[model samples]
Target: MTGLFTFGETMGLVVADGIGPLTYARGFSFGIGGAESNVAIGVARLGGESCWLGRVGPDATGALIRSRLEAAGVRTIAVPDPTFTGLMVRYRRSGEFAHVDYHRAGSAGSRLNPADLPPSELREAAVVHVTGITPALSETCRAAVFQAVETARDAGVPVSIDVNYRAKLWSRFDAAPVLRDLVGLADIVFASPDEAALFVDEDDLLGNLAKLGPAEVILKDGGKGCVAQIGGERHAVPALPVTVIDPVGAGDAFVAGYLADRMAGAAPEQRLTTAIAAGAFAVTVSGDCEGLPDRAELAALGGGDLRR
Candidate 1:
């Protein structure tokens, strides 16, 4: 069976209960959040096989991450380490403002090395998906990502990369060269217009990104939908109209949708349609992976509410 293989840091998340000052918030909800792992879950929910590999601390939080991924139908390869799992705290400061704090420096996930990936899985996967977040974590993690991409290339597997750049993690000066190199190595690349500007000219974002070497280039423009160049085809897919309760994880969902269909040999237009629908579903719910829709749900999107 065709599958998606991914690796990255899945961190413990602590989110304040209600909107307002976190100090006055009475309670918090615990969950897991990670870019690659979220994509794995999204693919699985869309009826595609997916595997996630990462380093996890010897703590309850780490166990929770593994369990959650398993529940979401993703195969997990969690490496145990003495270092603590990473943590991210999020809270809504107001109706429109949300604040996030990261406590992930030197965490176990940051300790990922090239040795963590199994050669067998790397060779067998239909596509290897990675994100900019892992390489930004630490030197070892960066090496691991590079190693995975190289290995996938050697095996003739397609590599998909999402430039999910976090300004809080590293400055553009430090990230530009590294991300540009990764884009050059990828078969398919996903990024926002702003993120693409970090490496290419703002005038022709899609054209410039394709020039960097990726045969497939996608600009995930959120509510504006996406503009993609796949092989010799150019697509402008629109987003499904929906009330967006939370916008986080929508990119991961979009990536997952495209990859799942790509693995199934779907046409470019169908792939983009599924990507847009999945992203629309993600924004209608809360949490990182909880909102990812399955194949059946994708069919019901934008239709009447009553389902027997």
Candidate 2:
């Protein structure tokens, strides 16, 4: 019952094999990338039982996504819809800059509805994690997120939310209020400094989040580490230093690490430490979930075995 549960969209990822524009790129690599699913993989890699709940299209891309999820040790509760699967094309050009194009309009993931989530599974998990990305996809997806949060709350389960705001999906003015509403229902919330600023004008971002009804609020600052406000106290943990290969999916790994530790009854500082390490591990790899470390690997990483 302490397993992690998450609901969101998983899309087929087409990454450029070599450093060049899509027009000039000779080859491409296929994988799956999604906030909630990545978190589920992170939890699974850290030795936690986790499940991914979402809808996919009856297409080859959907098949690929599910197979990848299963390979990552995550239990998938994927429903097939008539629409095609969502797709994300990532041009990993060079350095910290990458061009990404989303073709998710009217895709199966965007058509997520509350009816797709099974109540038995929703009520069984220890924590239900969600991201703002799903809600921004469409109104039905937003309703599904709301329903999932409500169901978790009603069944005495904890809810975790990450304010993964994307300007490409919606404007700040439109997203702020909706995101704030989701934050109000979360027990644990993760956000960057910029995302936190959208909710309140306070300099104490974590403190401001606490006022919004979350018991724990985490503020992640890239390279600057992360801070947590939990149980009427505050703790800060520094991120590990590693040469970044890809900047994407690190946030999901961090969230997964924290939740896995929290579920294992680890202290706030320990959770934050693992969270930072997981994030560091993520950026050092190419694929999203490929870089997530196991419990043993993460432990060794903290012990200064920096040779990877």
Q: Between which residue pairs do clashes occur in model 2?
A: none
User: Per-residue lDDT for 78-117 in model 1, tens only?
Assistant: 9999999999999989877889999999999999999999
RMSD for each of the candidates: 2.4, 2.4
Q: lDDT for model 2, on a 0 to 1 scale?
A: 0.89
Q: Give candidate 2's root-mean-square deviation (CA, Å).
A: 2.4
Provide the lDDT at 148 for model 2: 94
Worst 10 residues of 2 by lDDT: 299-308
Per-residue lDDT, model 2, residue 67, is 91
Candidate 2 lDDT tens digits, 1-308: 95998988999988998776678888888888999999999999888889998889999999998898999899998898999999999995665579999999999999999899988887999899999999999999999999999999999999999999999999999999999999999999999999999978767788889999999999999899999999879998887878988889999999998998888878888889888999998888898788888877876777212221
TM-score of 1: 0.97
Give the top-scoring candidate (lDDT): 1
